[model samples]
Target: MKLWIKLAAALLSGACTVASAQNFPNRPVRIILAITPGSVADAIARFMSQDLTARLGQPVVVENRAGGGGAVAAEACKQAPADGHTLCMLHVSTFSLNPFTMQRLSYDPFKDFKPVTRMFFINEALVVSPAVAARSVEELRKLLVANSGKFSYATLQLPGADYFQAGLSEQWGAQVIAIPFKGGGEVVTALLSDQVNIGYAGAGNFAEHVKAGKIRMLAVNAGSRLKEFPNVPTFGEAGIKPFKIKAWWGMFAPAGTPEEIVNRVNTELSRSLADAKVRQYVEERFMESAVTANPAEFASFVRQDYERGGALVEEIKRAAGNK
Candidate 1:
């Protein structure tokens, strides 16, 4: 009789767990950002967060934890409960950049977090200051060769930009040393001030400067010709066959979060991201909506991206004579 009572209680507990999973997010949800509030990352988070609030029938809040190259926020999110109430907005850097560049990371990006959904992916642009005379990749190659060690190029460490710039230098046999900045804004500032001759960063960072004609983009790594710069060609079109670089955005939850809750959030995220306004905002910023259908597919993509980045890191090290 005692044995029967124990079995009944176990069944009841399992049933309750399933029902709770169905009605998850018993309270407000918080989204943590690794960068500042005004960045394109932050803006997208804010835009989609509104739809998330409505779709989930819970208030969604975004908190900025901008320090340590997103490590600060990544750490905070990892330590939180796995109830699906907390999610972190990670850029390509969180997975691709930090792991390759930083030797000691406080948290394991792969182990400590579970994929929620990809947010956006944008191409990088190789732009030069107006002070420089290069107009094309070929011309820039010649310039980078002539300038060599005499010139410096700006990049950010957050997204592991060092690998991209280093690879470019190796491909062209240019010995220009890479200078690391905190983020894209600093890269743009260095270019504008003539503090650096060349910069590799997000298309959005260079969009305004390029439009104002303050800088010239030699080539882009976009899926197609950027609508804003219909005349410029992609890196492949420009004969840069050895390398292609892109920036990405995504969301992650604590590792132990139930698969059911993960799928549920992803479902709502896909639907909300499809809203006309949010889609328009993403499109206008030279970003595309995530093509993932659910958490499993998105997790696969994140893993693949990380693996690809590892290969690039090794290639760059070999080319730069640093390995």
Candidate 2:
């Protein structure tokens, strides 16, 4: 009699789970970020929130849980119900950089969050302030070798900028310190003021400044020359190799979120990216909108992102001799 009762209860529980998923997102949805409120992360999150609320017919909100290289927001998402209402919108760094850079991460990015969709990829660029005489990367490297302790590398929210800077410094056998700022805006400010000699930052961060003649881009990490700068060379053309540190953004929900909700969220993202206004906004920021596949494909890519991130971090640590 007890065995029969337990079996009935299990079946009932399974039914309830399916029923809840069908009524998914019955409440307000919230997206959390680990960046400052006015940052690119916040802007994208708010934009997505507005679009999702309109389409999903729920009051979607943006929550800023900044700090600890995105651990703060990620952990908050971890503890939330896996109902798909609560989500995290984060940079590629949270998965690609934090694991190796941060000494202790509170949650496993892979296990705590389920991949929903890839939002966009920001083209990264290497640039120098007008105070620096170097016009190209080769020239810049030579200048650094000559004036070893005089210049520095500016890093913003992208912490791995330091790792790449360090790698460059090691390769060139020069001393270009990695100076970190809170956001891209600040890095732009410092670069403009000649407080930092050079920086590897999102192309969006330097676009206006580059146009105003405040700084010069040494090389850009893109497939080919951008229409805006038809004359500039790509990293490969500049003889800079394997420096493909990606600047991408993705959306995710709590680990236990139902697969149905995950697929729904991904669909919503695809729709938003296809929106003409949203695409224009992304382009204005010097970012390219993504063409993401379905949930399972994105999840597989997320797993690969972590694996590649781990290997890159390990390589950096070994090169720096971090025991």
Write down the worst ten-residue block by lDDT for model 1: 155-164
Residues 233-289 of candidate 1 have per-residue lDDT tens digits of: 988889886453357888899888878888898888888778888889887876767
Please list the C-alpha lDDT of all candidates, in the order they appear.
0.80, 0.78
What TM-score does structure 1 among the candidates reach? 0.87
Q: Give the TM-score comparing model 2 with the true structure, all chains together.
A: 0.88
lDDT of 2 by residue, 1-323 (tens): 99999999999978877887788778998888766665565676687678778988889998887766667778898898888888888776688778778877888877888989888887778999898899988998898889887788887544542556655755776767778765666778888787888887677778888999998988888777777887788878888775535667888899988787888888887898888888887777667777877878878877788777777776766766742
Count: clashes, candidate 2 = 0
Give every collision pair in model 2.
Answer: none
